[model samples]
Target: MSDLRDAAMSSKAWPFEEARRVLKRYQKQPPEKGYVLFQTGYGPSGLPHIGTFGEVARTTMVKRAFEVISDIPTKLISFSDDLDGMRKVPGNVPNAASLEEHLQKPLTAVPDPFGTHESFGHHNNAKLRSFLDTFGFEYEFISAKEFYESGQFDEILKRAVEKYDEIMAVMLKSLREERASTYSIFLPIHPETGRVLYVPMKNVDAENYTITFDDEEGKEWTIPVTGGNVKFQWKPDFGARWAALGVDFEMFGKDHSTNAPIYDQICRILGWRAPEHFTFELFLDENGQKISKTSGNGVSIDEWLTYASSESLAYFMYLKPKTAKRMHFDVIPKAVDEYHQQLRAYETQDTKARLNNPVFHIHGHNVPTSDMVVPFSMLLNMASVSSAEDKETLWGFIRRYASEASPENNPTLDDAVGFAVRYYHDFVKPAKTYRAPTDQEREALSDLATALSSEEAALAAIAAKNAKMGRDDPLPEADFSDPEFLQAIVFAIGKLKEFEPLRDWFTAIYEVLLGASQGPRFGGFIALYGVEETIALIESALAGEFTK
Candidate 1:
């Protein structure tokens, strides 16, 4: 078998193990058309947070694993329960004036306070889709609104009617155990109409909307109620949906572990198997608060993507074990670099012999090497500098530089190029800009300027000397570093620094370095951006006073 396949087979990732367990559990059962992997979450009443990505990303990982091992088709289902009533007005929703009226309406029908969409639910749902697509996640997205409108819940409702007493008792028991009380079972109430629209529960004889049971006193009484048709009442609902969909695996935050038994109960009720569960801890921000959109405390995937690539984002997600550990964005760059290094290591055919392997290194006697590569930001910066704006360029860099770079390098030359481009394009300060440089940053710049003076002078002398050489003559890399040429580079960088606000500084630097003012980073930016562009930008930055 190819090493990649071998590695995948030996993988310890949750997806792999959960998929195997699922396959074995159904090994002799009636053939299923396929397994469904579910990621369920409420639409953000506020901006969607990074935790939202955790649900989908982890589920997608398991889905891919099923495809890899079991030949069992896997469908990633993103269940957006927008039909659920709006509980609290999300901060992002502007104009909270009509919120009270919106309480009973399906979230999709609720008007956005911002007045940007037909309803607040519609606006938030769009943000969720946009966020998922930004990460290239493929899912069979289903809204509770559509499921209700389509009457998929008809059979479920009928079943609830037949088992009404039992289901209610179970739910009520679970609720009481959890120290909660409910006057009515949670049902999807049509936002437009205050009435509960019943989808007939299949195979159950429900008499009207009333169910009756004899109390301990033996006097039978009818209670006006909607069938406890919703997934699970109490906490077990999560498990019921899991079994209903044949989910092989699902993850939850640490807070949900107390309700784990609900999964078993739901499985028994449906006569379907339960999925393996992995409980990841809550993500925390730098300030030590648990990451949450409700609290306005956590960074969202949208925010992270502004500084990192989708792969890098995925890499970071996979860094910790999918159980009981929290992560912050500040530590993400390192994880991304490590993942890149691993990819590079996987590509090496003679990896065992290369003591100088850039992607991996021996840790101890008779020990296998571990992978470590440049950060994602570095690669991105490189792409930003180059004319090429695609993943292929970045991938090629990994393949080509598998023998030279190391993680110790803050941003390798390649990374510098990528980071420069990314910083310039995405976060570049425009108009009036104030860049407050830390003491360390200032020192680094001063050191770079001094180094540039000699490098420029040397390059200038070499260009003059090389002028006599034919265009076809072989160009030596060393010729670009003659002392006089190096000095000229120093002068240019120094001159460029005098330009006004940070925007002007970057513009002048790029124009001199790459002949493009509106492009990638300057120092590491040019070097990592693209080799060809780096050379071009060097020439440009050398030119005087960049302006329109």
Candidate 2:
């Protein structure tokens, strides 16, 4: 058996475990279709956002996990609810005034403001497809408009018509007294204004699958239940789609959690079971405010791609997806670092342990080897310290630290260095803070700078000083790869008791090197960025050049 198959069979990772649960549930009562369908719904109300990418990326991960464990043919349906009526113009899109002219019309019928597609819905749908395709997600795109217009939903529509009163009862139980009176499962598209009408149905011809409703002007009309003549209300529409499409698994945001029971009831009334549902919390901003597109308070997909890789975004989505996560510029470096960390871990972990690692699942069990010389956070600092304009400068430091590392052998790190350069310029450079060093701190920094000629000689000097002070742990033989060396430097300086607060010594180092009070672990930074370069940076800071 293949190594991946062996690991998957023996490991109890969450994705694999979830897949097993799904398979067992199906085995107990299998669908007539014999395969699973995973559906991800998108509303083409505005430009596809980062949240949209998260939904698809997460679903694709589960789908990949399912593929690994089972030979059952599976399909992911990227369904766009483009037939829903447009209530208002989206603030972010172009030509808001044009959209206002067609208020309440089905989105598919509204004219495209960008002139890139046939209609507003078509334009947004194209964008959604293009965006998902850019990530190379395997999904079949389905449009609600085309699904209804092509008679694909005819059978389910007829069933819903026959059970309209039963479906209405299920829907009305959840509504207030006032709303329950006017609620109708069927919303007929007005033949005159071409808008979806919410007016009460005059009568229902259950025998013939037809409904009679009055237009806004009180003109009476009757329409067929199928062929896009009518669409169900939101709750029933969700249920009808589940019944019609035979969706086996699907997920939505937590905002829809309360509606799940109602949707399930509606589905049962329509003679179909609701798909297995997973509700995930919404994405939040860095300050923990909920990200809302209308509020313009969160990052966009294009913005994230400007500074990080798509895989980094995927890694962000992979962790505890059911819990809310902050998606902002500040989260990028950590996500990139974690992605690289996982790649590095995958190289040395045993088969069972590898299965538990996210990179194993993120790459669909085909974890590729990497020779990353440094973490992303360190590279970001390196770029900042070196003022690197491009990859060459970052690579110079990389090659100095690890002579064998190169762009050709470590493509992931090479790409990350480029991203780090862009991120440092865009986010880090503007917020940098540098402080002038005190005389005593300056003296210590100067002494450290002299040792730049040989890192070992500097370690021995610090060790001898520590021994003279009768400290318990003196500096050990220099090994930059181990963080203990840098920690020892901080500890040895603290033993001098020059500063009241012991942390001040480390803080001094960070402020001098990064112009920030906190940064990458100093030892790791020096190891990856070379001792000579680190000494030069400290000397430059002491010379008042960095403060300028």
Candidate 3:
């Protein structure tokens, strides 16, 4: 047991810990469904956001960990509650005024305002599928409309009919009197109006699997619990779906944590043990407000992929699931760089160390090597200093730094180069503010420029001397692109000019040359941008060119 399996079993990583808990569940006997089922629920009231995709990504991580430690087969279901009634028309969607008439109808029943799909629910569900597919999530898609309408939920629906009073007794304890007075487990889909009627049921005929309820107009109607006649109210649906599918694990946002016991009790009443559940802290926008699709407060999943790889977004989701994350554009470059950092670290790790790595959970057994030569943050800084308008302009510098690299051979680097350009225009370009250097700063920068110019002159003399002796190889070029060498030169100048703490020197360099208050290491920037170019930039800043 001292091998990879032993390491996997003892790993303290969150996904492995969650998986071990599940593995303990079926230690005596495998599940009757022949596999452990992991389910993630989605509400199709609006287009899916980056946070929506995160739920599936996190669940997949746990599912892979479970596979590592247990022999039991596993399955994942990306469930959509499309039968949920549209309580209010969202202010963001097109033709929202036209959707008012359809309020209280199941999302699947309302006509799509977008003129795309047959119903609004389908439109949102399609978007959700596309978002998940973009990340290559392996799972089966189940729609609530299809599950209930096709009679797959009939058995559980009938079970709820038998246990209706018991379930309501548990639910009423959590609700205020105003809500408890009219709440019923069954919400009947109106046979005529096509709206989901929320009226209290007068009687539950468990023997016949039917419900009798009064509609809004005080009209009496008796409908079967089976088929498309009725759907469970959301809270009951939560547990009933768990019982119906024999789910072993599920996860949701922390907002649902309070209702977890109710879901468990109802599932028990329906003759199935509750699934193990995880409640992750809600994702937030830059302002710390909960991220929402309609509020449009954070970057959409597609929008994130616009300037970064899908893997970087997945890495962000993989980290600190129990803590709230601010999902904004500014987090992209850091996520990209950190993901590659992990990938590089993975190359040297042993079995035990690999088990705890996020990339292992993220990629499962199919982890791909990171081909990014330049860190993404460095690339963004490069974009700022170089003002690269196109990927081609950045590629020229990249090819110089990595002599053997090309777009075709280094696709990840190529993609990052393009991302840097787009990110610069959208974010950095808008926020940049330039200022002329202070008296001490200007003097120090001039000295640094002189130092580089002096080095260039000495190199020219050496090249001429070597030509006279026919040693035209030019003394092996001194590795001028090495960041440490360039950094040493900058450090020497900062000390000679007596800049307190030395960081002040770099700060002035950023503000004057890049028009930003902070930047990447000045030496590394020079290494990538070329020594001569940086000297010219320093000369340009001393003349107050950027301040103008």
TM-score of each: 0.61, 0.91, 0.94
Instruction: Please provide, for model 2 over 1-548, each residue's C-alpha lDDT reduced to its tens digit, 9 standing for 90 to 100.
Output: 37766677667766676666556657666557877888898888777778888888877777777777777888999988888888788888788787888988999999998989999899888878887888888899999999999999999998887888888888888999998888898888888788988888889897888999878887899989889989878878888888888876777889989999888888777777777787789999888988765455678888888888888888888788788888789988888888878888888888788778888777875676756668888888888888789999999888877888888888878888888999989988888888888887887677666654466656765776677677657447776555567656645555554665866777887787688766787777877777667777887888898778
Model 1, position 370, has a per-residue lDDT of 33
Ranking by lDDT: 3, 2, 1
lDDT of each structure? 0.51, 0.80, 0.87
lDDT of 3 by residue, 151-255 (tens): 999999988988888999999999999999999988999999999988898999989989998889989999898997899989999999999999889999999
Q: What RMSD does model 1 have?
A: 11.7
lDDT of 1 at 5: 41
Candidate 1 lDDT over 1-548, as tens digits, reads 25434454555655666556655766776347455454555555566777777777766666665565555556677776666556666654457656866664556767777677777667777888887876667787776566645656444444545555565555555555443333333343422254233222222236664444333334444433332224223354464455445565667777777777655665556555666677777777777778766566756766666555555566556545444444455455555555566555545544232222222221111223333343455454445444345445665655444545443442433443454345445543232132333343344244344444344443443344345333333333432223333333433344434333445555544433334334323433423333344444443333322232
Q: In candidate 3, where is summed lDDT lowest over 10 consecutive residues?
A: 457-466
